[model samples]
Target: MTRSVPQRRTLAAAAALAVACTAGAALSTAPAPPASAASPASPAPSASAAAGTASGYATENGGTTGGEGGATVRAGTGTQIHQALCSRAGTDTPLTIEVEGTVNHGNTSKVSGDSCDTAEDKIELKRISNVTIIGVGGGAVFDQVGIHIRESRNIIIRNVTVQNVRKSGSPTSNGGDAIGMEKDVSNVWVDHTTLRASGGEDEGYDGLFDLKNNTRYVTLSYSVLRDSGRGGLVGSSESDRSNGYLTYHHNLYRNIDSRTPLLRGGEAHMYNNHYVDVHESGINSRAGARAKVDSNYFQDSRNVLGTFYTNEAGYWEVSGNVYDNLTWSTPGDKTNPAGPDPESTTSVDIPYGYQLDDARCVPDIVSRTAGAGTGLGESDGRC
Candidate 1:
């Protein structure tokens, strides 16, 4: 079976063994070691000592801190446990926080808990820089964001699985956005992660990942976004004047039905991806943004290429693709065999290339279809 990110609620409760630190005198009393540990390590130096010393683990009130401080926190049974870890990092050193095992939160009764309040983001990276949060072999889950990076830079979140991220029990608030990078963050790379959300009352905002306004130089690759109520991956400009650049490549997306509108921003490149069982459209480019969708595979997807309702002088090169078990939103009338609806026509050229008999629909675009062949007829024409 295909692997998916775990639900936030489940992770919050089950993965609650990690350690946490808070600001102020609370540091005087460290929490107990996880049940699995034979003997936990002592806490790092006191906040004052850390600040004055030249050692790597220094403390700062609000300014930035440098050097790598390795901290391993167990995923405990609630958001409180996760929050403690974020707080203990003291917003200083570019912490390399590693997590292992399962964590659960929101719901009560360690054994028989239901969905608790959304897990309030397992780790909140706020106004910090140069941090790397990595997860090893053991799986981890979060009810909200596995990692919420806000107003930070030079951050890398890799090799993690963030499943079932929801805001609240209410349908309007039930979006399982696994990773949310918001508030003018830049230089971020989210790679090799799997995000999944399923069976929630709310479908409008169920995205596997999202990058908001004032975001630039961001890359998402080699990830899986599936079984969500919303889109697999999304990016948006919070304001009309704000600029954003995003690159989404080599990912697998399946069964995403969220209704949050597609992004319309500066520049976006989406290429060499696989899409399957999508509810609305496989890939949507809206709001006048310039996007290049090429060399991808689309199987049993709804609207293969939807450039409907865009304003930002868009351009698309739809070529060298194999279309099998694919349906267009607007199949052409008898008069127009090519199905170029007047509304669908743009300054760009979207030409038909090849149709393969295999189960996969590989596009004929040079950048997109070079990696995977749909076993359809070969295309002599360049994309």
Candidate 2:
């Protein structure tokens, strides 16, 4: 379903919007409350009418209507969450789980059942469909626990925080990813969530958000991923090229070393994200990946876009992006950077409609609207 790329639109209108601070006034950029601050009131609206409604790829493939027209349950612990899924009427029975408070390994355990395939030490959503897990009340934090989605579809995770999960430490979960999806997973939307790790791979942390093994039709918006060596990757390796149709918008990536994220092979649309302090590399699009990189702000980063560590190249069509105080590495047999200055090597036609924020104000806009809580606040797109 490839459409011809449209002519590049001028950014004159976006540049003129530099003075519209009030447009972003509705967002909450507060640093306290840990980004996992309390949750929005519930008896939530259906998927089509919810606040901070999902856009982008998640809106395609028959659209992601997670747990719509279903019963709602409250789960405070991982065990309770597993129980909720186990109690479903059928494998595809729609259900919504409103999570509150802290969920740690101590309070989480495997629950065996007919409807789900559960595992120990992780919040496992596997071999099921039509479910929503949203933070509520005082907030939901998966402390040292990770969320794993496999062989699932039509799922949503919102307004929650998962941090400090590790692969080599005393406690490990989901191969150390804050959230991971694989094995034919599709139609998943993760929004207004915070995913962080204390350090890099050597320090036991893996990726913050990762997808692999044919996962598709996913969107990660208004989220925050930071302080990890690896932000995430689309496919596990250059040969693992079955994943595609991902949208990452209005998110913040701070102090990430690399792979923000490494796209092996796929079509991805990335816009309005703020990338700061990317020490090694960012947005490694390689192995024939095609990305529509638009209106993003990259600051204090190195090699923010390119094929790295391999000669197999990827292509991108970039526009309206602002690179501030960035450094470019010398091109080598194994490193091909997209800067000094970046230009389009290809074009991508997006199928959905989205509002673009001025690149100059992305940091401010993202800060205010991204991460958990803030009642799933979103930009009115005036900024």
Candidate 3:
């Protein structure tokens, strides 16, 4: 892929995003065990049955192995999902829940148990570990609801769609975040999922994917986050700076206003992603945060990278990115634009090895392989 003209404002060096694809062979839908049979014998691990693998930062901090070597269950409603978790013998008991239908407020309710801390109006995975929730069959949609993860670890959510969750105006879930994690979360891999909202906070929608309160070791890959005011955030506020160690790649962010994630404090690697129609700002790295932005494709966006809305600036290392039809805003009290021309302000050393797809192929590659469907597909690891 032909790279844009390199522009340097500080140190003169070229960088390319080294991002790895996080996908396993697609899983096939198996017949569901009855709800009462919560721990059905696990199917033999195969390309079609094994839980998806973890990559990126999820491969760190002891790694994320959600529900591996555990029993598998099928859930068609929200209640059953909660029941499946509650049925586990303990918080760390491995279990996989394959969902196959709509999971919403009407069909979901809290099920109390020693193993789970749940609530109504949302699908909660709280105070737990070693769990996987994957969509199969016709697929799983959490419409007008959200998936909330709190104080949890070693969790994987794949091939699911969460949309239109509201924090106000009647029904609300996960504080209007389609997928939210907070309070000591660790080692989570969310892949091949779709998270979206209709409008901004004024329209009752919040972030599509948000993390806060010391959450760490998370990766979001091969997914789509679109049509919302806020894509997501790492820390809740400037003071909430404990969260860190994130990786986002092979994803699509389209028609969003800002915060392709607003990082507060931590290190993040963003690569091989596609951004389109980012109306306001994108990738707001602020409050002493540091980001390695590489080999990404940004088109028809404005202020696609930099610290924003704060005087406490974040830093970024930029390389091998394509910017087409994007506009830059003037630097102001709380507005800092990274381009019309971008350069590295800092340097980061990634602990993991990754592949770099040329920025030229990113838009086409991410479009075909991202989101809840397409059978959890992946690129060929080639340009």
Candidate 4:
């Protein structure tokens, strides 16, 4: 994004933020970005912008091919999927598990008050490594169920629709997410998937994709996160800040309240995504979290960036983003930028090679390329 204004005081403000965070004045930082950070339109990427391809950071982290060269196994039942996971030869052997039809977990698991025997309710991808769970063709639905990944590595979930994970209004049931990961999980790529809900938190729904408790090296590309109270969380708790090294790009986030992915104490790279009708908040980086926000399209959203509600200081470096018909509020700290915003940002070291769509073309490109069942056809998700 080209800037017409001069950037002189941006680094000074960042230094001040570093000092404030170190001095412990910040309890939890979640501030909104200043109005000056974005223009009505953004500049498109140059001839050489890199987009994160399937072979990119989102998948195959450090040459870890999850089920890349394995035998294909198709499962028609939810129980069969679980059985396949438990029957894998080893943690490093690759296996491609294709799921078909509507796999319902309600038969095995039921929610009681605030607790759910998720042991019976979820397709728990536990104690497994180097696995890729993909939908077979156009229709594989996980209804009222969750995909829980724990203590695993080198996993990929693609071309699936996870929706309406109802557990009788219990946020604690089934880990409260469509796709949830925790407990030392690493190297996950969720691509071309749909994680959604018809109702909000008042109706008992939770996050779309959540990673917590030391989960790292994750990327979510060409996905849809919408119609829910929470989008996702990087670190689950305030003290659980060691998790996060996540990437979100070329995705669509619509009709949401907050945390279009709440990041707490970790580094996140968010770029080339479309955010629409965000009612309350978005991209809440808090508790010493750092976000590199670049080349996004925000339409009819409010407080789409920065820290809010918490006093813990969050840091953001923003560039090449477009804000059209966006709404903002001057509330508290960590949500609002003080002076001239950074036209550029501190470099985040990512180890993959890819292409980047120009910021100005994000709205049109993302609408066509994001979500499940679209884009470059390969899991690559090129715009």
Candidate 5:
């Protein structure tokens, strides 16, 4: 789906306040669990069952053996494992499975009639729930999405590396997103994974993780997102409406632009993360949304943070952030820089309890590019 840019600065002040409020709350509370645990009765399905009818099985000399209660099949030398896993019948029973090995044209030829390319297998999870697919150290690479979950819920994807996934071939909308969660999916966790867009120069897909519609209670943490043509992480709703609590913490975004906005109506929290070499603002909150961007380290970013083209009712709070080698728009330039910038925006009325005591905002490069001359400064705010 496409999004029309909203009016810049319309809700900037309110967004700043909301960010401050959320940051205060987050600072006062202890860290929550990395992933939400499901209820006892709703156990995950078996590895074999999760990957319907395991047809192929392959393992490296030292690869781990046995499925973890679900359809646990070590991908063998060919596409048999991928095909079997993708076509397996999904069970409502919650399951935890591990996928290992590398599958490309080198191993399996094609997945006969599957819509996905044959060299790589595309597994579709339809209406499955309470499933966790963890990757062992060996890694699983897919020419397309390693796994696609649609209309599913309460799922956990951890410690996996997905590469070479593209959305389209066009420069403007090419490079398929690595993980696409249709509108109906909810309560998912994606952590400790690396999503790289090797399709250089192509308009690689928007998000390493993409969610739409009523998808809720999602967490993305400790992952590395890089080389995305559009943005590192992207999320949206069909009609400026969203469902669930979204939390993104401790992830690294490198060489990316236009990070996802907290839009379509949901509660979002982004904290304790580091952003390096980003071309756009660290966080974008829009369309009558509420989000918190706090305690993040931003380095070499064009624009630091922004709330643009949002409805009047939209809210955001940004605080406890350290900006290094950050830049704002050129003087007389109304268009904000692409990444987070403390100087370009205003401070909200919310309580900013955490201050960068001379320790933060230590600039390695600050020069006059716009209206007043730019220079280095220290944080006077309380910690």
Candidate 6:
């Protein structure tokens, strides 16, 4: 039935209870014990939801945050965010838009594509540079709106949750993507954010965070991506070799099906992340793509890391990765082996200096710090 992660979790608990009841009614009636009672409760979200959001999270990239020296602007709701970006869409000046509470896209259409079009379809960050868009306070959520980036550079988006950005439910709707970028976008840092959806294409959901058409120098860190069919990508197509040099670190990717990201002809450093309950695949490093897969934890996943689902091959230098209960099959010499395996291929030297969290500590560190609204903030796993 393709139950979602939350749904499956609830169902599994119920099933366990039913089993317990069958064994002994008194056992099922007893108050349930707290799961992992010995583990400490995670600290409060201490990262300021204001202008510092980017700086707080982007420190993972050696302080190369694009919005490091930008002005700050506070905003709430979708219209304000859209208008703020549109106002500076064609400018080169820096601006920081601080978002609070929730924003809605109004389920518009024709934000991107051509012809059968409407003006209110997309909230495009177009032709802008040196910007920081951050979430502040309790929670910041962009609901049911595709946030598009185009011809933009030097941007930092942190501590925001983009979810259910589907459109008015039509064949031509160009919304649905939680976040997307294309056309010469560069030097973007997306951190401590949550990009999610309930279902796949049938529900009008697209990529959580997709990069395309020469976008480069990007980093996605300390984030949570889940419950969508396509997680994300590096290049837009088979010919997109120009867009590369990305880093994905300390993120929690759960309940996704594929593209965990489908890297195409780009160099990506994917390390210290956690992939859980990925149904079909994860990290499809394909189309001449080179990936440095290091020290990630993958649990209850199938084909969690590999060169797969296409004829074109990809290269990976994997080391210190922990594959717990990961399922795989040999597809004609294209074997996806989860480690504790020695690196068999040439290692791709990452340009920046960073620490590799012990594979055993990934789940603890990531669970404590990754994603928005974590009490301890994005404080852990910084460079």
lDDT of each: 0.45, 0.84, 0.84, 0.68, 0.48, 0.68
TM-score, predicted candidate 4 vs. hidden true structure? 0.78
Candidate maximizing TM-score:
2
Q: Any idea what lDDT model 3 has?
A: 0.84
Question: Residue 266 in candidate 2 has what lDDT?
Answer: 91
- In model 2, which runs have C-alpha deviations exceeding 4 angstroms? 1-18, 21-52
- Top lDDT prediction, candidate number: 3
lDDT of 6 by residue, 1-383 (tens): 12212112235433432431111111123333232423332443333433443321233334445445555666776566655555553366566777777766453322332211124655567766777777767778877766788887778777788887664464222545788888998778888889998888777788898988988778888899999988998787788878788889889999998988989997888888999999887888888888888777788887776766567888788876666666664554444433223254556877555656656567776887788766425423221
Report the lDDT tens digits of candidate 1 across residue range 1-383.
21211112125322321323111111123332223211111222122211111100011122122224434343334443334334443444444444444543442122211211123424555676755554443434444444666777666655466677666643222233567767677767665567777644353335667667565556665567777766533454324424345656556677776322255555555555667676655555545555555445555655555543343333344543333355454422211111122133333321211122111222222222121111111222222
Writing each residue's lDDT as its tens digit, candidate 5 over 1-383 gives 22223222226433543432221232223342132222111122223323321100011112112223454445533365445444445445434555566644356544543322233434455565655565544455554444566777666665566666655543222225566666576666666567767533344454666666666666665566777644433345336365546666556667777564335456666665566776655566545556666566666765556554343334567666666566654322223333333432322332212222111211111111100101101112222
Q: Give the C-alpha miss distance for residue 139 in model 5, angstroms.
A: 2.3
Clashing pairs in 2: none
Worst 10 residues of 2 by lDDT: 1-10
Task: In angstroms, give how far residue 250 of model 3 lies from its true place.
Answer: 0.4
For model 4, residues 1-383, the per-residue Cα lDDT tens digits are 21222222235433542431111111124332222322322222211111223434445346435677676788766777766665666556677787767878544342222111125777777766878777765456888778999888888887788998864564234766899999998888888788998877778787888889988888888788989888888887788898877889878899989888788888888877899888777888788888878777777777788676678867788876666555556545445421123233245655554455545556655666566555223212222
Candidate 4, residue 293: the lDDT equals 82
- Give the range of the ten consecutive residues with the poorest summed lDDT in model 1: 51-60
Instruction: Give the winner by lDDT: 2 or 6.
Output: 2
* Per-residue C-alpha lDDT of model 3 across residues 205-300, encoded as one tens digit per residue: 999999999899999999999999999999988999999999999999999999999999999999889999998889999999999998888887
The alpha-carbon lDDT assigned to residue 228 of candidate 2 equals 96
Pick out the ten consecutive residues of candidate 6 with the lowest summed lDDT. 19-28
What is the alpha-carbon lDDT of model 5 when measured against the actual structure? 0.48
User: Higher-TM-score candidate among 3 and 4?
Assistant: 3
